[model samples]
Target: MNANVSIQSYGLVAEFDTPGDAMRAASSIRDAGFRKWDVHTPFPVHGLDAAMGIKNSPVGWFTFFGGCTGYTTGMLMIWFMNGFDYKIVVGGKPLFSPFYAFPVCYELTILFAAFATLIGMCFLNRLPRLYHPLLKNRRFAAVTHDKFFVVIETADPKYSPVETRKLLETAGSRHIELIEE
Candidate 1:
């Protein structure tokens, strides 16, 4: 296996011709007690997540954290810069008035959350990764078209190329191939 192309170190990939077959294969793979696998499709397929046993993404938590940071920073900035440091006496209002700072705080909260969501998603997913070992397998191009693919990472304790391929075949995958990472 070439180091540049193999991202997972070892894995078995099974390709399906139709989304229905792919979904069925996913369910079968889950029922077979295998974990550490992923499914790729050309487009969104209903019930695919449930079949793969994937839970909701954790990106929301990251966005929340970003919002919190933004809100706090915005409030502090207004308070120190306008209220305390400059001591603006507009309309005879008291310093550190929450009413005047509400808009800035609200805007900052939204800005930070959006920024965090984008950056967090990229970081968590290891984005900017231009090279993937899976590319070495020319057959994987079908994933962008009408094909569906399921890859079981070799890192899983239960994974073996031969056994995995056989399982995929039994599960009705049309084609099975070894993907080196």
Candidate 2:
């Protein structure tokens, strides 16, 4: 690596003393039409999602589809074997009935639903990320403990260094710093 390599700015991070401050800052950032920004806090904050203008998650849809697939697959498999492929008659009972397949269908529905939820969450979050510039910032480490933070990425079209800094300042940030990549 070259010693004189120039570091690129990742974004601006503002630290707030309380979740309310961070939520307010997030609302302001959201209202400003910034597309790339986030707020971090030690724990979940009530109404913060609304403040950030976040909509409902689509993960539930994935789970629903997966469950439907699983149930359909179970029913079809049972029907193919019992009703179509090789018929078995015992005690004058029907070849296939939904009551008999209910156990397998129910189990598969739960299994596939759980798998889909995990996969959807990972896909939506873009997980398995090995690194992020924010992880290197010492000040940001407080986010996991006591502090709340709002980060506005430089990639956002609405981001202006001076204006963003001023916005954070006005939003009641106790400290603000530029992150580098």
Candidate 3:
């Protein structure tokens, strides 16, 4: 069957009328073992993550480590600059004062964590998508309005347009489209 697939197409998109249906479809897809499927909705849907079998995002770990590194760097910089580099013993105060360096270390920790979080989010989500084949589907526009959708990528090992379409339909999807890459 010449499905007329495209290189840009992530996969097939199936539109459901309601969040309930979409959630059900997502759960079904998850259970069916499609690893690269995603559900799109106008707003975040409760329990959708569980339905998708997604675990807690790893961004938190990135932030935590980034913060730690930042804190260490900040502390080290303060210590080295004041104690060793310049050796400015001002007002008879010790050069490596932990109390004086606390704020900078705290700020640097937050700053690095923030940057890492942004970078991690971008990397994890594959941001700057620029364009998606689903955008070509006029019906997909409703996804941002009141519609919900589930997209199963063709790159999935189990992807079969015919079978996937049937699965979506069975899961209560109404408008199923073969999105090109």
Candidate 4:
């Protein structure tokens, strides 16, 4: 921290001692119609995704489409280059046999699907996020150790700092801090 620098808030974050309390707080916030919020815990908690109203991730869809495209492209490539274009004739074997292209198609399908899954994940998670205001909070450091925290960002149109604080307090947050950017 530099003395000349001024702190700006990114959001209000609440720390809870127990995962149960944190999970409850997440549900409360979701029910309150706040979208720009998240819950962090030291380890995975059961039913938290349902409590937070998280839907299935789109990475699977991306991977499916990518695999379809890869299969089509690979099949067409093999068919055209081998059967239609070059007309490579071997001993008693059809150039356009599906059996011959199976391995190539399978490899390409898996390759494309894997690439799409990785890219989709990165895009959806907003990766390459090198910095965040919450990272500056000392208390937030314990999120990876043994703390359950919920943060509601200022970006939410419905966010009310005073009201949010009251809600968090009601939800059983032991300590709260406004993380500065």
What are the lDDT figures for the candidates, one per model? 0.86, 0.92, 0.90, 0.90
TM-scores of all candidate predictions against the true structure: 0.90, 0.92, 0.91, 0.90
- What TM-score does candidate 1 reach? 0.90
lDDT of 2 by residue, 28-83 (tens): 88888888999989999999999999999999998999899889989999999998
Candidate 3 structure quality by residue, lDDT tens digits, 1-181: 6678535657888888889999889889999999988899999999999999999999998899999999999999999899888888788888898889999999999999999999989988899689778888899999899999899998999998789889999998778888776
**TM-score ranking from best to worst?**
2, 3, 4, 1
Candidate 1: global Cα-lDDT? 0.86
Backbone clashes for every candidate come to 3, 0, 3, 1
lDDT per residue as tens, model 4, 18-137: 998999999999899999999999999999999998888878998998898788878999999999999878887998978889889888999999888888899999987998888888
Query: lDDT tens string, model 1, 51-79?
Result: 98888989999899999999999889999
Worst 10 residues of 4 by lDDT: 1-10
Rate residue 105 of model 2 by lDDT.
93
Best by lDDT: 2
Candidate 3 Cα misplacement greater than 4 A, ranges: 1-9
Taking all chains together, the TM-score of candidate 4 against the true structure is 0.90
Name the candidate that leads on TM-score. Answer: 2
Model 4 alpha-carbon drift over 4 Å, by segment:
1-7
- Model 3, poorest ten-residue lDDT window? 1-10
Candidate 1 Cα outliers beyond 4 Å, as residue runs: 1-9
Better structure of 1 and 3 per lDDT: 3
